[model samples]
Target: MQMGIVRRSVGALLAVIVLLGAVPVGAAEKSAPRHSAQAIGKAERAMQEITAQAARETATAEMQDTRISSVMLHWTPYPAAVRYAVRVLRGSVGAPMKTIATMEYVYTTGLHLPLMAYGAVDDLYWTVQPLGYDGTPLAAASEPCPVREAEADPAAPALTTEYAAMPYAPLYPVYSWVPLAGQKEHEVEVYRREVGHDRYVHTLRGGEYDVYDDTPFTVPGTYVYRVRGVTAAGMPISNWSAYGSFTVAERTPIAALGDSITHGGGAITVPPSYQLYDWESYCTVPVKNLGRSGDTTEAMLERFERDVLPFAPRVLIIMGGVNDYRVGIYGAETVRNLAALREKCRAHGITPIFLTATPIRPALMTARMTINTPPSDWWAHRDYVNNWVMQQEHSIDVATVLSDADGELEEGYTTDGLHPDLTGKKYIGQTVDSYLRTHFAYASAEAERRVRMLKNMEKTS
Candidate 1:
């Protein structure tokens, strides 16, 4: 990990060359500004309210005063906003925020969101990021709008860990947990809740915050895990939290492979930091970011076997093609390269998850470099690759969310249209997270439950 990171300095140098050396395509006509002065002023005021220092979470015997039934994230409506995506946070304003779900529509100035069986009452923070007519985010996200859960629980019981992925294990399955209050030591029970079986497999004792169950899982099928707290005397304390599931196969980490986008980069420099954005910082699953700036599909392939195969990840999210298209590489060649990557993963028994290339804002692209006589129809090429990707299994449709109706990056999501800002990057990360939460659920019971809930929300929304 320490490598470029020194290499990041090297990548930074390469990135500047890519930005300046490359010319943007797709010339456009200017119209009404995407944002107006009035809207910006209102947003500024809303930011002040949302980002204001949060008061200390006062401890109360009742705790009920802090419980909130609903959370509403609000912001000033921008003239260009056709839809708004709201992210809700439950802790401090400045700390990393967990994006629960993205609302599909912007009915009014604000959206009232539901919680995940949130029984605790205290603090919640939200940010509203507007979207263009196309799915692209429209403007800067509203500062973390703080909300309080106005309900109380009987007790502030010790909760479980917010583990990322719970993949299968033949060696030792690692489980992460939060420490239970009032207990210096706690017991954790790991259950083997797979199909055709229902029982506690292991009641681990005196383990660290993260318990690694070394027991060999001889069973070769999908395993769902649920952990519950216990006293040193093997007494139960809190109820079991949500189940974390992973299959028992070639237990490997998940790999995110791509170019600068995968490397977490935003276009433009001088003031904005060039350091790669840590997309996994908020992910629910533990994923290795193997993204490098200025890597085309060919460059990615050159290093694939060496960097990725070593981990033998359970799933590999392969998102490439944009960098290939940047240099006017034929769409077919890019597709061929991606197909090769997919085949390699399949050959190694790795699950392949592909993502469509994100959209580019033409205005930003044009301003970045000299418009060279490149491929006349870059849009067609992009669509061709995206169409092919959509036909495959385990495909992540991020391009749809980032593109405007005109097939360009939504102005709000990018400063240069080729790369995403924090607002855009967060949206992409959360969207991938939503997909993973559903896909990794080997147990259909939990999977179906979430799908049904999303459908209901869609109907009501």
Candidate 2:
């Protein structure tokens, strides 16, 4: 039976060729007699049907093995390389997909590379998942597969901007912009202003990015920065992003503390007690202003035990004496008042930060009748007080000039001539805040307790 079946199949093939008139046509007729027109049409239709069935079967098999997804990389300046584990598709009938391999990766400046598992052809399905190198869990599902055709993976772009040098121990702010569709949970970048230069310094690649409260940038100078997203396909999205510029504060925190320009009038905020907003969007740390609109060093001394000392602040910023100058308190008396305040803070283990009085704007001082004290006298007394404060090395962290002998708010940072308006407040607050955040690592609860206890102690003192 098998021999007969094989012979029949061979015969069918031979018949198909002969029926198509492969031989030459009759000489006189100029054409050979083709198979009956009906027979030829029938055979042609049958062949088309068979070919269509085969194509459908092949398509079904291919479709069964195909799956879509993508991958993305976050670039940082940290020297360590990023690692990820891929959970591959697994199982024949009842099996489950599981992690099969891990990979090491590097980030280009603001660039993300998209990758594909080479083995996952149309014959097999795959899904790529991201995992921390050591399984510490940096991110999971950082990228997607079969990226959208119309829109490129938002992460495909590379970032570019001008260059600046980094400082010896620069602290950079980290940033990441992964959207909702990304598989990864968080991306981060660090940036800082360059010290002594008019530009920003940053590490090209950050090793690992944290999800919350990325580090604050401490580099100085003014410069621009740019960042972009990258998909895993290793395709570069050639687009430059906008730049964020910042100026490194010329005066250090100690300088700010001692500089009279940092002093504010009326209920000024104090340190160790941050007044962060409820939304946590802006600065809201408790600060003991101790800055009465017309208070002098003498007044501050009277209020120190009641107001300032109780906070038990790790750092104490003291800006006073303009009022003292107006009241004929200068030279020796001014020095004595400041010295007393210093002793009070130190007795409670607080580091006193002092600032020289900012210069009174000569033009504005004459224009605004609000000036009660002579600018010349105020300036002289300020000089004397600063000289005296500077002499106390242990009690004073810093005692420096805010402006020249003549007061002038640095270009855009000040709103008024004497008192710091909103902008000045923010600028001053940031400087003070930076110092406290760095030096005093104590928690809010502890800080608050210290403040409360100190205040109580003062009642008995």
Q: Cα deviation in Å at residue 63, candidate 1?
A: 53
Clash count per candidate: 16, 57
Put down candidate 2 lDDT per residue, 23-62, tens digits, no spaces. 4455314432554555567677755655565556556655
The candidate that achieves the highest lDDT relative to the unseen native structure: 1
Worst 10 residues of 2 by lDDT: 272-281
List ranges where model 1 is wrong by over 4 Å. Answer: 1-252, 270-276, 369-374, 442-461
**TM-score for each predicted model, relative to the true structure:** 0.42, 0.34
Residue 230 of model 1 has an lDDT of 64
